[model samples]
Target chain A: MSVVDLSKQVALGIDIGGTNTKFGLVNHRGQILAKGSIPTDQYNTPEEFIDALYKEIQPLIDEHGVEKMIEGIGVGAPNANYYRGTIEQAPNLPWKGVIQFADLMTEKFGQPCKMTNDANAAALGEMMYGAARGMKDFIMITLGTGVGSGIVSGGNLIYGHDGFAGELGHTIVKPGGRKHWSTGSEGSLEAYASATGIAITAKKMRAEFPDSMLNQFPEEAINSKTVHECALKEDPVAIEVFRYTGQKLGEALANFVMFSSPEAILLFGGVIKAGDFILKPAKLHMERNLLPIFRNKVRLVFSELDEADAAILGASALVWEK
Target chain B: MSVVDLSKQVALGIDIGGTNTKFGLVNHRGQILAKGSIPTDQYNTPEEFIDALYKEIQPLIDEHGVEKMIEGIGVGAPNANYYRGTIEQAPNLPWKGVIQFADLMTEKFGQPCKMTNDANAAALGEMMYGAARGMKDFIMITLGTGVGSGIVSGGNLIYGHDGFAGELGHTIVKPGGRKHWSTGSEGSLEAYASATGIAITAKKMRAEFPDSMLNQFPEEAINSKTVHECALKEDPVAIEVFRYTGQKLGEALANFVMFSSPEAILLFGGVIKAGDFILKPAKLHMERNLLPIFRNKVRLVFSELDEADAAILGASALVWEK
Candidate 1:
């Protein structure tokens, strides 16, 4: 209600990816007022990365005349820990071992900092500004290179005891079936439902149907996008691939529904671009597998967040949580 | 803090079972000062049952001189809904349709009343007075005639969107494996880890090993208790049966851990009396099935509540929750 309060309401959100790190000055309305990026893989040490980020972001703060307005900083990174404010053993990150990310950000920016894994950030983003807004209970699932999930119950994101809960991707859906590439776990949801899994399914289907349209492209050329294009053309092999992936994803979602009874499950990321080609089977199978009490009750929807700004918005929302 | 406050601190807990409905006057310290039960099946209708219950309990209240001390009442019954405060179509209870159990109790006793399914009440009880005291997150499992579960996260019971969350028992552990008599779903945890499941396992093992000690008892006589006793006596057939059951339970628990990542999981009910016989294998398999980050981090323990008083105490704890 005061001018002083309005002047000091912005937050800085940073999303660190394997290649690039995106940063933005975000307002309480989930709007990104200013934004920039730095190459994440270039820095050999986290200290160097933080120094570069501050150098690039400092001018933006001054230009906006809102240096004092930034209340805190929130970061979303691979393998980040909310409890410890550290990123540990991220396979794709440039840094190795554990990095005290939040403490370093706080020291450099002179503000409080909080951090969590990117998927959890996305869930918070949805809860704050996306399709899940105003909803207290839901599951946010990202289907990228590998499957990832963020669980929200009773209007709060579950950080678990160790801050590494909500690993729905790693939950075994098929039992002794396909093996995960990194964890070596068999039948994980990641093994069957991720974009990588979709590509693998396309390859398998191509091999099974020798005369299929997929045969026109070499095996290496096949990806989720290519498969989607082919499926849109009514390619049987590509259509079957999506069907199989949706079936596995739907069954797993049904089990998740039983576990938490979320009001809705939101799908995000690249693979979801296939839309009803994948969603129809996913919803059908999810309902098919659910118990009678849960059938037809849970809504399955797509994320409404603008993909370009979702990460920054999600990370920035964490600052408000403090 | 004051004598009047202390006198009015007590609550009445009621646990309604198929055969017997138990009642107790309890304090905040989880102490049961006075308790009794009435046969649930003797009354033709809920109205008659409520009248009989009040008649039996009013005398105790007068004798304790705490008639005015009881602050509120809480009831735990099968199919009870926490949100709607009703019990619906309980298979074992004499009531066939949706009953306004909470409203009736409030009207009869002239006090506020709350209700939840028996398992959810047990979870609340544990959070207030049992193994889960001081814990913000945990899963409570009761392995009775069938498997039942209650989930707590952020120090609150997860009622989900429909007041029917935490149905881990029905989550499919083995897809299309064993048939659930009630839900008709196959390979549910209830079909593999429940008391009935143990008896089925015993009978199957007896059929396989004709010379086993289990064969000495008629196939109809074999039950969870009998299997535990046989395993204690070093009967290989019974021991194998427990190992198989534990393997299934542990695997299912691992999936649950990935879903919520609770601080600990507490096991209760008649089947858990086997203690190490069941726990050791369950823990081993659960740990074996978990992702490396989660392995050895979650505590698997038995419920510490006295079985005779646990249900009543759990229900009574609900009054304080309001």
Candidate 2:
């Protein structure tokens, strides 16, 4: 009989981004043993992307050993389907149509693989290792370039019938409000609550206050980070940007709370770095909008995962969670 | 061992409404053996209500025998909680604070009892025997006096942390648009989508079109049923009322679709009887608001369960579903 080394077992986690793709070999404790990155946009075809991924990850696989990967590989990508193991028409990816992502990974690596959208993976990561450690029901909102959400009900991620549930970003928060730059959907949560949305809010609001601190920087320089820096200095226009974004986010959150009645809502990504500047307004509006039964019950907090490492960690959690 | 009489095995289902309380003796096959109703508002205290229920049910119990009731009792009320088996702060009920409802029923009947809010009970009824049969994921919306919702995710009704999830009616569709009569909250779905809301809309819209048929009726006679009748006669103002209500409902539904992505959303209650006048506009607006991935996917249909029987059937289902 052979004895197993539990500590050596690891899963390969891959996060496919529009610009960069990151991969890491992680243990069950969420510690990354080895990690690497490859530019995602360089590949023109799904085949080319898979080939590049295989060549890059082979060394890590050899070092980690197939026998040690009891949990196998997990991938998180845009438009990914957990039930189908495919990426269908990902707006950001170079691939134009449905790509059998998990099938290709399994065929190349000879290990079982699972896939889910980035938001759902983040939710699993939070539930397993981060702020929502003991919660059975909670919502994870990722406020990056665009808003994304993962809903957990009855302790399980809501995949819906098509494995494409939890699209709260696209939910219309403002009817006939701001139009999205990409999807052209008006008043979507993503149009106002995201990092891109904050930049837009900053630019628009600064125009009204020509002498505001935000106008000191070039138009291109006014992003979420710049706005945060200005807010720290008590800049009035900069403060308004966060308040506007928080109101939209908080109202949408109130609707989500009524839908699933989660215990908490965990905010992630760059916009959340504004901290209480954004958090306080969101908390206030969320309370004001909620029914008395739901008011003062749902906790709104920031995620605990390291942003630079969250994607890879989140993807890896899919293997263990599944 | 003695052979069990399968045909006689039954459950006692009780549905407590604000005006009256209805109950039935039902078998496993969804057949009601006997039923009755009693005024609910006359009771001054919860204890008096329970005593009245016991007195009314005792005759039926004597006839059926305890051995025949294998499934025990299940109660559905305004603010019932399944976990704690209590009714808490029911706004429409005579009781105030928390009442140990199911515990009292169990003590009175010498059998286990379960309890849940009426809408959730209706959802269980739909899942077990009506529109949502064979479906694991669907949402139930009752559009009558108020817009009540019951969310079924992965085949189970979502009873949130405090046993109060799925309050879609309370979700605000038009911020600062309309004030709800009872809740005092502005722009709630119930303020626009319910029968009461439709009557309010009819009264407001009819003033602009004095020549419309709706103006012929007294303000007290302006309601969902009267508007439907007027629409059937090609009344323009009446038709506009449904269009406005449907628009709000559909928009709210689009938000819900993105949240849980249910396979279907079942509409019940008297308001749904308006048929295509409401359904067509609702379908159009719902599709118009949804993201590309979600458009034309979810089935929005009226529930198959008879409205009069739905509450009792839903309550009875708790016995079997448990």
Candidate 3:
């Protein structure tokens, strides 16, 4: 083996989402050695959660012969802060307070660790391994429970003056409208465009048209995939739902385009699984809404990165970026 | 005068808006020697406009004995490009094609000259002489016939990969619903919030209520000023107009904050002249739309810089920055 190859150490990459905590052993080459996920119990304390993760990962470390070659651990989670290295009361997580998650991982593995918000981690992943691999400027959007965005301009992640920039989801698309959420007051695109939000919108439409084909599925059973399937079958309700969602997304993106003027916005997560169902209208509305200067210039694209592998890759990539 | 003071050369700064072009001669000390204006003729070609500007400005340059002390000229016009040093098909300008405007000024004066988009120049002015003095991160918004924006982040103007990253006015606030004259789409905040847009909306509302007090004025005379007067009197139509415009402005700003997270957003121009009429409602709605992390952290403020003097200071400061 070459000396250059021996010098590179493997990293432990962890992604703690609302439903699962996924992790992998990865090297600088973007190669994964071992990867798996564990259910994230809402009631578990942070300490308990870390212990559970350690139990699952320790065996992988031994299997891969990576004990001494491991350099650090990198983590991505909702409300995680890169600068502070802590998770600050994530809404989805049941934890009530800030948690120094990286430090806990470090304590368990006796290795240095770093962490950042999941959205930012995804951007780092793109920069290191995916569509944005060679590009210096772009924006990444994750359309899951809530819309999350990460901006990369001039090859660096933009943390802003307070390290709190890149809040694209909350950018208003409708100035005065209802969002069907507890936030009360309308106007936010996040109200109707996120995965849960889109599902809610479909549910409400089905209520208004009780006899529509959409009523065949219970509200809880509705998801972006099912919505896309129904729309592909020429279901009018599903088509309308996707069109409306796309319209909102397009408007919000028009605002984003004006701000960053990024090369493209990479879309990922559940809602985007509908693919062109959401993209077609979004492109149409966005093009119509954009200034002539931006006409057909900014691209809306689906992430080329693997969603199943993205979390671990992004988390591992964070260590590489550092 | 001290030797240092005598040796310092001045720069002529001019900001050309749709209504007027404000001029100033500023020395290296950031002091203005003379300030004045001339009405902009919408029918004039780019060359004819330059001739008119020279006629109006020559006497002021002679009056201040500024000819010998002036080192260069700096101009801010709609759609000006700092990189190309030209104004190409500006929306408000009557000109139909690219005008080598900087070259025209340089050929006339035999001095190095610089130019940028009006909004960008105003942003630089704010950084050099106004509320954002010594501050590196802020956004300057011009609320006029159309909403225009200039952004400064990390001590540098955000020119983007192209010199067009800060077009905050074109951001979409309503999804698939309203057409903006600039972009020909429904969604841009500029469609419902610019002074012209506000007037358009008022006209539509007036048609709905023929006997309303707003109809007493000529259609051409409808403006934000008139809207403010009526709103102050609790006129229902005018109140709704301000509320609607303010909400859209606030929502648009929420997107900007997401991308920039600047220290503040500085408001200026004719519409903002209504001050609290536009500011109060915009502030409330902005807070409502901002993410929890940014809530109440960023500020909304009016420009503290003198409008006329600011242009020249900004122009002169460009030389200083170089």
Candidate 4:
């Protein structure tokens, strides 16, 4: 639209996972110009990982003819702190202790860098380019290996005193109902609403109904994806499992609505692929549990970002925010 | 202080309740120069109520030499909407339907006016003058006839889409456990943690322990105050009631901390007067339920504002905020 708008400025986005780290060069409009990945497990230390990552991404910047146009870098990583720019005691990361992630990236690339937990990055991405565009208040719930949430209030992500807010998955949904593996707390939302929780539900259901079709799969093989597939085919036990999961998720969501009063809640990650099989019960239970003022007011929808590029896009949004 | 700071500015603070309405002229330093109350049931219509309120407060303004010094008016009432400046279908208020409360105040006072639900007003008061001063992210829980909450995140109160966010009392704590009187939702925080809930616990404990000291009191006479009195006298059933109440409250608070990661949670109103009787168990259970990252970080403290002046102070804070 203008000379400044059309300028060739870009930013690097890196998403660090336990197994692999994906990096990309992205423009202001959330377009990924070039992207690559490196296996994270190969590095013995964070320094080696950073070295390999920089080597792999340097060519992508040159190939895009934006080596000089590079602005900053933004990273989305587990247990990353926006205020401290460190990842502390993240269980999944290879590093044993605290890692000064953003500082390392800044030093390596000679550019400003920011980092936050992955869920918070997803929230920024949704605000900038996806379902939550033009919205100031919303919650992003990632129902993946473990349930995670990012809360946006007054157009800012809520990083509490410790830079570790928005831990909705750990909120107790059922008092003394189920045990959370990590926190050892009972009836946590993660214990009932996460993908792992769904698989656990399948296992419990199979034991309850010995003749159910869910029994055909080995105990360890019954994951959320398989449960979704079975539910799609009208397997009674699988359908019940999703229904139970939605009920728990919906109830917890109602409580979240009462807390921050977000305009909408965007559901992301693997389990949401079940769609209406999960959404239908979630909506029903959420409405049923909501106080009259919040009933029918909050929109519950799935994340619209492409799964493959969402983390990269989300990280890029952080750079643009700066 | 600057010349402008000493300029004798004041705000009219009004706290509207079901039985009585308290009004006061408060200065920027949270000092009440003049205050009074009127029976709320005297007027059948909202216009009549407004007329009476204005007539009563006009003389107080003149008595305090604050006619020209009055900056604005702020009101704390049930079901008040910050965005629309209206009170919608408040069950406790005498009015039958939606009332354009803030607009009416502005018209009558000839000054700026603002309104929010009573709990949110309390949150503003805390931020300005009470325990939450200098703190941006915190939760204020008012433990009274019903459990009310005001959530402050990123230095702003979260008023969700319909202006009815932060209804923590109605958030389900124990699914299928206790039915809330208002929403009929089972096991809401209000069902167990409010003053009324404490009385119900007393009644239930009396029934369970026929020989207990609580059985000496009539069912209708058992209330939070009486229960506290009994606990002070070492009544086992009453002590157990408070313990159970605190356990439920603490667990719910743990969930809240995980959601927003507030710096502190300020407890206000009648039940908090029980002090350590409630706080100890609440703190214990809350810490027990919190994830390790959040454990022992959140301060659970009683409100510092004088009970008689808190509502007025809270309401007045809204004017200063403008």
lDDT of 4 by residue, A107-143 (tens): 8889999999999999998998899999888999999
TM-scores, all candidates, are 0.97, 0.98, 0.85, 0.98
Candidate 3 lDDT tens digits, A203-252? 88878877667888876788787788789888889899999999878867
Per-residue lDDT of model 2, residues B102-144, tens digit only: 8888887888999988999999999988999988889999998
Model 2 DockQ class? medium
lDDT of 4 by residue, B65-84 (tens): 77887989999998999998
- Stronger candidate by DockQ (1 vs 2): 2
Per-residue lDDT for B12 in model 2? Answer: 90
Which prediction has more favorable TM-score, 1 or 3?
A: 1
A37-143 per-residue lDDT for model 2 (tens digits): 99999999877888899898888778766544557889999999998999998999888888898998899878899999999989988898899998988999999
Clashing pairs in 3: A174-A187, A177-A186, B178-B186
TM-score of chain A of 3: 0.93
Q: Flag regions of model 2 displaced more than 4 Å.
A: A1-5, B1-7
Candidate 3 to truth, TM: 0.85
Rank the candidate models, highest DockQ first. Answer: 2, 4, 1, 3
Superposed model 4: Cα runs more than 4 Å off: A1-3, B1-7
Error of 2 at B213 (Å): 1.0
Worst 10 residues of 1 chain A by lDDT: A1-10
Q: Chain B alone, model 4: TM-score?
A: 0.97
